[model samples]
Target: MSETSDAPEAPGAAGPPAPPAHPGVGRTVGRMVLALALGVALGALGTATHRTLWHGLPVGLLVALALTASTALLCRAWAGLGTLAAAAVGWLVAVQVLSMQGPGGDVLVTHPAESIPSAWAGIAWTYGGVLLFGVVAFLPGRWFARR
Candidate 1:
């Protein structure tokens, strides 16, 4: 009769264990900074550049994409950062909105100086960016660590 022994597998025996399902504090903070930086860059782009036939579409679209991807990475990297993630995105949106305003303006925020309807549309577009970020950061995902 053969006897089996209970023992742990050696390093690499399992072919490198999966990375942690949740990122640590450093990683979370780093990602948050990255998100903030990207937001700032996009905001600057909107402010520094003139709106063409493309209008603010290029800036808005880029912001939406960068914010969504970075915030999603933050949430997926760490599971407990729902509020933080959402708030970070909100802050990003706020910065972008405020950037739209000029040095001396009665209104809260405005971009490219459009008419009433177009201005309203721009505001909606800004919020929609936040919404997309929130959806990606808050929605439950299918995959998680085995822990």
Candidate 2:
């Protein structure tokens, strides 16, 4: 004997829900903008903290680079290539602007060879962040798949 239910089955009751559609243009743009803002904020934070030392170790520089790497990876994992590019550009721009000598002759990022030991912190912060961004951006896309 066979039995049949009187109620109709719901359209999607037999399978997993559909994957979400890709983001709209406005949302994508907004995400990229937020990414850029985050990058700028990170640059400022790194610049301010890249000169600290503890027991003759450049702990501040290490922290700055770690932040840079984390930010880049976050961007990539969040929205793919566009956000990553925006973040990298924003970070580089902020770092360069901060590195310039102010009217008072103060510099956020000094030449590595100019100071005995701490000066290298600035150089590392500036260039190492760029390198980190580049490396994260170029990583295999499969690694960042949204599955």
Candidate 3:
């Protein structure tokens, strides 16, 4: 005769960890709001600084793009797709509003056709932010799973 037993592994056992539970609606909403606020701030700051040139290099644009990607990655990793979308929407809204001509006819981000060097920097910053954020949001699902 043979005896066999089936039992679950202990918590400390070496095995893949369970996936994290979905966050509650309230928590999700909170995360979204915070992410959106951060995104808007980044957008404003990026717009203001994207025109800087140091030794003929667009250092400000590069830094702004890096910040945008980092922020989007944090939102995605923290709360998944919805939070990321909220952040992206916030950034887009802020950027678009700021790019528009003000009552006095001043524009934070000028049209690329204006042929100003800063104008190209602004255009790159705008499109580059979107590309970086989208790349972070669409990263492989397994990469974000709990170990």
Candidate 4:
């Protein structure tokens, strides 16, 4: 009878070693770029159409909220995590842009002290609505997801 080998295969010898568990750097970078681009486009449109409406809110908040909802709806496969991540990334990018702008830009200028509370309230209105849309995206069914 022939002797059987009992040794296990080496780590490097496995069939084409499974690709990295997390997405590749290239893929991650691509997603970030895509998300940033989407945020900018949406922000520009939102700013243009709702200049007065957004005047009461931080652009970062608006961009975050909008991108979150849109990403959630578009990439249902990723669901909650994807929506949150996209929103965060979009917000970061928007914040960077806002910071680079002059003091008169949407994010930095301060209105009346008494109006501070109301301004925050307005920001919450748009921000909450957008976030709610993202949450809805996680729900079942296509029609339901679309908003």
Candidate 5:
């Protein structure tokens, strides 16, 4: 006579296998902070990638695209959005108030208080990166919503 072997199974087994345990709070926070830093760093570096009059527009747009796509791929939705937001705010503060300069040694942007009409005439270029970032931030959300 031969003996038969048996295996254990869940009752009903109606659901898919469970996912891995969630990350800890500290780890999540750290990742979020890192994401924010990555976006900001991209902006700063991209800004200096080229130096010319109103160079911020093109460079900034490139930065926005790179930062958004990279961060969204590396980070979760909330963290990625937070990173983009921080990048935009940081860029604004840096160029507008801190008077940060581009590679060519000209200030990238100015404080709006200087005179919106005049200061904004050619100053919009500095915001291209942040604006693009904002626009890209929605893409991930939409894609995730489908799943």
Candidate 6:
């Protein structure tokens, strides 16, 4: 009588391990949401504490720009710089529009030309601060991801 083994055969050869899950989508979305939420919350708090913090300093605008820039950077896509530039331009345009909506739309419209320099200055400051924030956030983000 031949003795036949009843043992099951193992995998022919352990197939290449499955690729690691792409955490990019979840990480990017989570970071974007958290950044926006934080920005809004901080803007509200700053506004409450001192309206000037939000109005005169353009903190909200800067925060929005920085968040936009960082989100694009984190995506590791080709559109990062373009997105940042576009956001800056959009913010500048929005500022112009808001300033034009002055009290009864009278003050600004009456002196639109005069307000251009100041409006541009404010936008410059906002974009500068946002760019700085993006640079600061990028390194730390990479470092954190490495660990």
Q: Best-fitting candidate, measured by lDDT?
A: 2
Judge candidate 2 at residue 122 and give its lDDT. Answer: 79
Per-residue lDDT tens digits for candidate 2, residues 44-134, read 8898889988898888888889989999999999999899999998898888898889999888787856755577777778878989988
After superposition, candidate 1 runs with Cα above 4 Å error: 1-24, 43-52, 55-87, 90-100, 104-117, 143-147
lDDT, candidate 5, 56-94, per-residue tens: 445444444565456544443555455556655554543
Per-candidate TM-scores read: 0.48, 0.90, 0.82, 0.40, 0.51, 0.31
Clashes of each: 0, 0, 0, 0, 1, 0
Selected candidate, larger TM-score, 1 vs 2: 2
lDDT of 4: 0.50
What does candidate 4 score in Cα RMSD to the true structure?
10.3
Q: Kindly report which residue stretches of model 4 are placed more than 4 angstroms away from their true locations once superposed.
A: 1-25, 51-68, 77-84, 95-101, 104-126, 133-147
What is the clash count of model 2? 0
Candidate 1 C-alpha lDDT tens digits along 23-124: 678876776666556555544443333122265355544554465556555555554454346445545665566645456764433444546433543454
Residue-level lDDT of model 6, residues 40-123, one tens digit each, is 443333222221234467564455444444544543332233333343344344434543445655432223255553344344
Question: Which model is ahead, 4 or 5, in terms of lDDT?
Answer: 5
Global local distance difference test of model 1:
0.53
Cα shift from native, residue 99, model 4 (Å): 8.3
Candidate 1, clashing residue pairs?
none
